[model samples]
Target: MHTIQQSASQVVRQVLAGKNLNQALSVLLSPSAGKNGLRITSQQRGALQDMSYGTLRFYGQLVRVLDQLLHKPVQDAQVRCLLLVALYQLLHTKASPHAVVDHAVRAVRKCNAAAGGLTNAVLRNFLRNRDALLTQASISEEGRYAYPQWWIDTVRNQYGVHAGEILLAGNRHPPMTLRVNSRRNSPEDYRAILARHDIESSLIKPGAVLLAEPVPVMKLPGFFEGLVSVQDAGAQYAAHLLDVKDGMRVLDACAAPGGKSTHILELAQVDLLALDKNAGRLELIGENLQRLKLHAKLQCGDASQPDGWWDGKPFQRILADVPCSASGVVRRHPDIKWLRRSEDIKGFAQQQLSILCTLWSMLDDGGMLLYATCSVFSIENQCVINEFLMRNADGRQLPIPAVHLNNGQLFPDDHHDGFFYALLQKNA
Candidate 1:
């Protein structure tokens, strides 16, 4: 347990030093020989993951509590992170408080032997004044919402009375939704297959299912056979919104891990071209296509600069799933709340507009281009689309088919993660 605490602390420390949570955790958990040469069991790995994620999820509140407990700055990043992890276990998990403190103290001694006493005192102090400290932490908006102050203001300014709900929703554990391959099975039949395995699930739509609890892909029957793929229910709307038809040329710019791209292919036998900037990520698209018995022409190239890869052929349909701050998917990735900045939004908007314009040129006359993002921010969704429409006289926005969206923006909720989709039609 102490080892797990120590490793989790290291992961958090790395993240605070500018590394994203996923990359840091992967480096620590990967099966590679290192100085420690420690072998992590599956159970230990799970514990470590929970500890790291929980610590980051409520990082603001935890920091506030720690600040109150400390007389002066600890000045040691390692010891500070260790206490943070221990506090999260005591506050959130069912772990024994005695064990948590003991393990934390032991873990701290290894990194900063002299600071072990400081660690014990701070954690014990927090336990004694848990209520007072918690109340004090909630005094600040950042602490209360567990998001950066700018992020809180941005949402409040944009969403008005509903900002609180949006911020709170991002802190909850995201639901694990699955997209059933339409060509292979129906949602009702897939629900039955899950039940036969003693797994409980609910149908979200024609091809989407929400699992009662997240399970490993190994436990998902026929997962390797590609009967279904894990995808957010909100994301399943993309393929349907693109309105692809058989024998049409479609471009999935920024396709990686190929969820939307494969869905587009599954809905219709279109001539699909999946393009991404990274060679490694493009490989992931290929792997998903292979597993599902779907075929698409995959290429590694920048979406903003398509002249290098385009064969001078125009596409009847283009899906520009541009990259952004990923504000909408924060529930699934808590690190984003801490890593993103206010200025980053404008930069993302510029990039989205650039890609939208670049991809617009690739669409045939009267073709439809679907702009999508896993972001609820209007700057990345509506603002960028509005800019494109204003700049191009021929481009006009079309209504999305989903009723839940507020002008093509789907807020994160119990059913699905936040997503924004805008369908634009070109008039020659």
Candidate 2:
């Protein structure tokens, strides 16, 4: 295992190269390039992953602290990133500030023109100002939550003051929740099966279990056997909402990585079509379907342009898990906080509207469509649904029945990622 300092330096270089934290980590941890492409042990690998994720998760506040202490304009990208890494270690990492700076300075030396002196100066300066900087960064909401200024304001406007805090908390990495395939084995049955392998799992809800420790799916019993699969509890609502039965046609629009699509099949026999815009993502859908020994007509096509891929058929059910700001799942992908812009919400709503309008014709009369998004932003959630309802000429809002759940809107940090679901039925 490489020292955390060395790993931090590498992560710093990746960040300096203009990559977001998750992107940088992906490359650094990509078996071919991480740790100089040397194979790291499993334990070391896990630690590096944690540090990289944690550092990026709080980069906003970390940078603020760095700026306060180092009273110089940081010009070089590499050195700037290195300084950020040094500060991250000092604040969030277990490394001693002195050792952190020493190793960072050496890392700088390895570059063509080492900034060892500057690195040393910056690190020591941060150490001297640590107490002050910590206090400053912790003073405000943005500092405390580590979100962008606009993000803080936007979430506040939508979810109000309290939910805004919840939104920020949700941006932390989500837990590894799994849904057992009830068709194959009951939840308790699977829990006992996992116990034999020392895999402790606690049932959080019926059919929903949280692994005490997430192990590789390959190591889990009946994973390849299709008894359980990794899925967030928030997402499991789809199978019931669609409520597929024998001899029904179902469309899983935007079904990349096919979790919901697979779950739908698990609930009952159905003629399923899982369509995604990206071929690469569709490959994952195919792989999951194969692994589960499930059958779905997996194809790559744009949901907004169903005519291009549709075979002139109407479906009894549709799952339009459309693309949106992804605000709800930010905890699982904290990089969305950095990678996404405020304007993206408007654009996502526009795209979703197009898909909803275009795909409406594909639904059979009296058939229902479940509109869903892993986004808390109003424009992408309720507002989009309202607009679509107003604009569509033949659409009828399906009243939420006892069987059809009403998940009005979920923001982040509410036990699950924020999500919105609306079930609509067309007049037969």
Candidate 3:
């Protein structure tokens, strides 16, 4: 337990130092000796992941409690992060408070012997005034919501009365939803298979299923056989909205780890070209397509610089799933709350518009391009699309039939992660 705490602290420290959470964990849990020079078992890896994510998810509140408990900041970075991790375990997990404190102290001693006493005192003080400390922490919006102040402000300003719900939703554990491969099986058939395995699930749509509990992919029956692929319920709307048809030429601009790309292929027999800037991520698209017995033309190039890769043919349908602040999916990536800045949204919006314009040039007459992002921010969603329509004389926004979406913005909720979609049709 001490080792897991120690490992988790190290991961958190890296994140605080500006490393991506997933990258930091990958390096820590690599095949070689871990950061602490210990071999990580499969079980330890799971514990480490839970601790790391939980700590960051509530980092705002934990830090506030720590501030009230301590007289001065702990000089050691590792020790500070260790206390945050311990606080999260105490407040959120079913882990025993005594064990959490004991393991944290032991982990501190191994890193900085002199700070062990300080760590012990701070944690004990937190336990003694737990209720008061929690009350104080919840006073601040950041503390109460577990998101940065700017993020809270933006959501509030954009969403008005519903900002609190959006903020709270991002801190919760995301649901595990799967996109059933309709070519191979139906959601009804898959639900029966899950029932036979004693796994409970609910049908979200024609091809999407929401699991009652998230099980490892390996534990999911026929996962490798590609009967279904894990995807957000909101994301499943993309393939359907793009309206792909047999013999249509389609381009997935900025496609990588190709969830939308594969879904498009699954829906119709189209001549699909999956393009992304990163070669490594493009490999992930290949792996997904292979597992599902699908095919597409894969290309590595910048989506904004289509001149370098355009094959002189316009696509009948295009899906530009552009990148953004990723505020919508913070539950799956808690570090984004800390890593993203308010200014970053504008930069992303500019880049998104650039990609949208470039991809627009490659759209055939009457071709539809769906501009999408996994962001709840207005600047990156409606604002960008609105600007695009103004700049392009031939392009006009199309109405989306999803009744839940407010103009094209889908806020994070119990059923789906936050996502934005604006379909544009090129007038002939």
Candidate 4:
């Protein structure tokens, strides 16, 4: 029990210290706690995990609830984190608030001598004002920077008011998605695998699967065997739309932890070159390939200046999954809601446009290029594609209809991550 409190507090402290929540938790639980020996129950372990993920997911709202309930600030690192954990349960979890307060008060006792009275008083205050907090936290920007104000405004402006609400709805929870490894298992075979494990999932498209209840990959059948990868159903569609074929010379630019790159390889036997600026992440890409026994030429290089690394020979197909604000995956990384600023969006747009222009020139004549980003904002999606069409004199934007989603604007919306794909075929 002492170890559980210490571990939970350590995880929360790292989150408050501005480390990524998932990475922080991994560090906290590395090889399990205890300097010498301690036996932690699965229930306790699950609670710590839930407390960490839940608190981060609703961090903006929880802090507001805490502020409303507490008079003096719970400033001690452990005490503050205890409050976050407690507040997360009081508002979000089905656990009784009294039980949550009891456990948190005990955890606080382990923190500081002064924390017991403060924790008791603050949690008692919460019980009294729960109704008011629910109303305030849900509406105010301070209470819910879980959704950014400028992002809210921009969504309203670009997509109109109702669509703005829909956009927010998109971040409420993560969509469960899967990418079928076409080399080992087709979409149909993967769904059958899910059925064999009593895990139900719907096939969204040619190679995409959407799970209603996402099990841990370890629990999923054949996960270690890499029969399928947990990719956004929308992202799964990229390799398919890319039209990678047997023995084609292809470049998967900006590929790190190579999901799409591997998917491209799975779809067809191709001479593929995968490059990213980060060498550390390249190892992860290599690990995924090793797991699947898939082969590809993986290198680390800047996508904006591929000439520094790439040979002069041009490729028949290029998959440029460029960097962006990653606003679409916010549900899975709630810290982004607080970390991102309205100013950052414009900077990302500028960089994304620069990358598009740079990589577009590298596409061989008569070759096709698939430009993708896991960003929901139009400025980073269609805006970049539209601007490219206007700026390029020689390159013609292939006219595609809304149905093909190749119309220079493909927003992957069906049971997938919010992704934008632009397929451009250079004229021969």
Report every candidate's CA lDDT: 0.91, 0.77, 0.91, 0.76
RMSD for all candidates, in order, please. 1.2, 3.0, 1.2, 3.1
Per-residue lDDT of candidate 1, residues 43-139 (tens digit): 9989999999999999998999899999899888989999999999999899999999999999999988998898889988988999999999999
- Candidate 1 — which residues are off by over 4 angstroms? none
- In Å, residue 422's CA in model 4 sits off its true spot by 1.5
lDDT of 3 by residue, 1-428 (tens): 99899989999999999999999988876766545455878898888999999999999999999999888888899989999999999999999999999999999999999988988898989889889999999999888998889999999998899889889999889999999898999899999999999999998743589999999999888999999999999999899999999999999988999999999998999999999999999999999999999999999999999778899899999999998989889999999999998999999999999999999999999999999999999899999988998999999999886664678888787778999999999999
Q: How well does each candidate superpose onto the true structure, as a TM-score?
A: 0.98, 0.89, 0.98, 0.88
Q: For candidate 2, write residues 207-276 as lDDT tens digits.
A: 5778877688789888887788999877887777676888999999999889999999989899999999
The number of clashing residue pairs in model 1 is 0
Task: Give the range where candidate 1 is weakest over 10 consecutive residues by summed lDDT.
Answer: 29-38
lDDT of 4 by residue, 285-337 (tens): 89989888899998889988877897888899998898988777766676666
